[model samples]
Target: MKRRHFIGAAVASAAALGAPMLRAQGRPRVVVVGGGAGGATVARYLAKDSAGALDVVLVEPNVVYSSCFFSNLTLADLRSPESLEHGYDRLGAFGITLVHDRATGVDRARREVTLGAGGVLAYDKLVLAPGIDFVPGSVTGWSEADDEIFPHAYRGGAQVALLRAQLGAMRPGGTFALVAPPNPYRCPPGPYERVSMVACLLSRINPTAKVLVLDPKPSFSKQALFEDGWARHYPGVVEWIGPDAGGAAVEVRPGVGEIVVAGAVLRVDVANIIPAQKAGAIADAAGLTEGGWVPVEPLALATKADPAVHVLGDAAAQGDMPKSGFSANSQAKVVANAIRAELTGSRAFPPRYANTCWSAIAPGDGVKVGATYSAGEGKIAAGAGFISQAGEAAELRAATYAESFAWYDAISEDIFG
Candidate 1:
């Protein structure tokens, strides 16, 4: 059968079996809040694998999602922001109801989700995957109002464009300062990749330019690999300061484009401030957060507050998994299978997860770190992992870069298609 026709038939069959039409027929409803990597993947797999036995609804505020995974490439002009934007048409074709609205509240007592659009969705199971929100007041003199002066660009979309434009408008021989977030934030390797991309761009436009990274943590993901690449690819252009060296004690003055580090003020051309982050606000509003992020059972991704409600992705404090798109996608599959087994008597398998984070240090130079995980005593535990070694062949580095591009395409398709 033709692909289009097959999808059409699938949608028709799914709608017929949906809860709205088949509630009297006893179809179980699964309402997913936050249609990102985790939420979208769970909704898709539940609806597709259930073969019209489940009613799945996805709630997301954005009509098009610009992935944070490859967004750093936008700064280096390696990829367009438009290329990272994906729509839900393919997901809709699989018979999931796509509601483009924000979730205002989740009522655990009633198992209902309140929508900003003035409707309540009741579900047999609720999944929350709202991603992360920056902690207020974490960065002095930096807020949403000052985003133009100090772009976070961590959430992708317009922020990415804003940072790219700021990089382009930077004066020659000026310094680009980056304030890295604390540990346990989304995408551990993200800030370093941004530094590399900014360094790459600055080298072409302004060889005499400098990039300063003020990090709260002493070490970062793939530290040796990134440091080696920085020296080899953009020698003397990038400088990193750890907390012991006064990177932690810092304040920013957006009004004057200056950053004060260790009691020394330095004027900067562009400042990218990534403050500490926690689970999204909705998760807090639902009373799911005890210490800023929701704690979940590793195997089922079920919230400790309520088992009927599952939390995945960055919001859930699942051990050993970095808050990356790949980790979220992996966790979503486990949750989907568990939910299916509960509703449809399907066999539930043991949960296993994996994640790989790829970083582009320079053009044609890429590196990665990844691990396989299993549910352990009280948390998810890392099993085996690998990282790119130092002093690799140039061709091998190029191949790694190529592999990253391929992974991007494949993962995006896996989530949205």
Candidate 2:
């Protein structure tokens, strides 16, 4: 939205592992796609644990990554976009080759990963953490033509810059509208936290301006905490329309920047819409879908449809866990460990996931829910996790939630660093 965003400084590759030390070259090459949380974690663990025995290559188009973990706080302006910036120098240091390229398709039976550069990477095992992409039709008025006005900003980099620019330029008494996607999308509490953050930013400069949320679902992740924080901090400045209130729009009009819901029409100065999603194209091409998402074995995240392939992050069909950066980080670690046992002549055993999602309604204010899961028959089920709950203790809300910020740091360090 601004003419362009500043790209991050490229990092120098520092070797993390070597072939002879690893004893892994001829053993089996494990290639990971998507250098976000999941891909980064898997690559680091495999390279680190294999001790140079395994061939690890991480393919991601961007060198620097912006985590969606605290994106809501970023939207609110409590955190600078720089706080979320990360790169792959750390991955290189860990001895994983970092390749900057777009992945084209997979020669599944051939065990070859086709790249945009026209080179094919052979892998004994392939893990995909490429993340989710939006479906254009989910929001009626949204289309390529509207890209200039509203940005989903769900991904990273310039997209974050565009949203920041729009909010900065808005005049006093302006209205900001956020079009929330259907349930089971990335970062369930993300939409609400984003609008909350925007409201926090606006409350100071343009006190009269309002932030509205058009949520497709009747409820969302961490609803109680978000509402309480909003009521105390933003009050009338923020409003939400759930499905009962006709927040679920049937269509979008990009030309007019209008969203239609149950025969009602609404237009706004800024709109951010995230649609329903599936795994990235690479996942679908590799036979990862039972439906839109890649169904996998719970503990290892190996493709249930194909044992040789592993799926992690938003791309994998881990139904119970909210597809947050933390979930991907946790899942990747388990997958990495599992891959080690299988290849290193040890049995790593089955896997389960530990996922936690935290949201910031305002600076210094946070709420989070987490759980430990176990493998169920066909899917992963709640084992020792809280599904959903109400109530907000200022102490647990503040102290425990402050740890959410730490999570971003931990995950990044584990992956790239």
lDDT score, candidate 2, position 303 = 85
**Where is model 2 poorest over a 10-residue stretch in terms of lDDT?**
2-11
**Candidate 1, which segments miss by more than 4 Å at Cα?**
1-25
The C-alpha TM-scores of every prediction are 0.95, 0.90
Top-TM-score candidate index:
1
Give per-residue CA lDDT, model 2, range 1-417, as digits (tens).
Answer: 111111111112212233221213355778788999889889999998888778787888886788777776766667788988897776776668776777788877777777775556677789999999777577776764566678888887677678878888887788888888886688887887787788898998789998888887888777777777888899898888888878876566666867776787776777777777767888877767766789887768888777889998899886587788878888888899989888877658567678887777777677777898777877777777663234556676677667877877777777677
- Whole-model Cα lDDT of every candidate shown, in order: 0.89, 0.76
RMSD of each: 5.4, 6.1
Q: Once model 1 is optimally superposed onto the true structure by TM-score, how far is the C-alpha of residue 243 displaced, in angstroms? A: 0.8
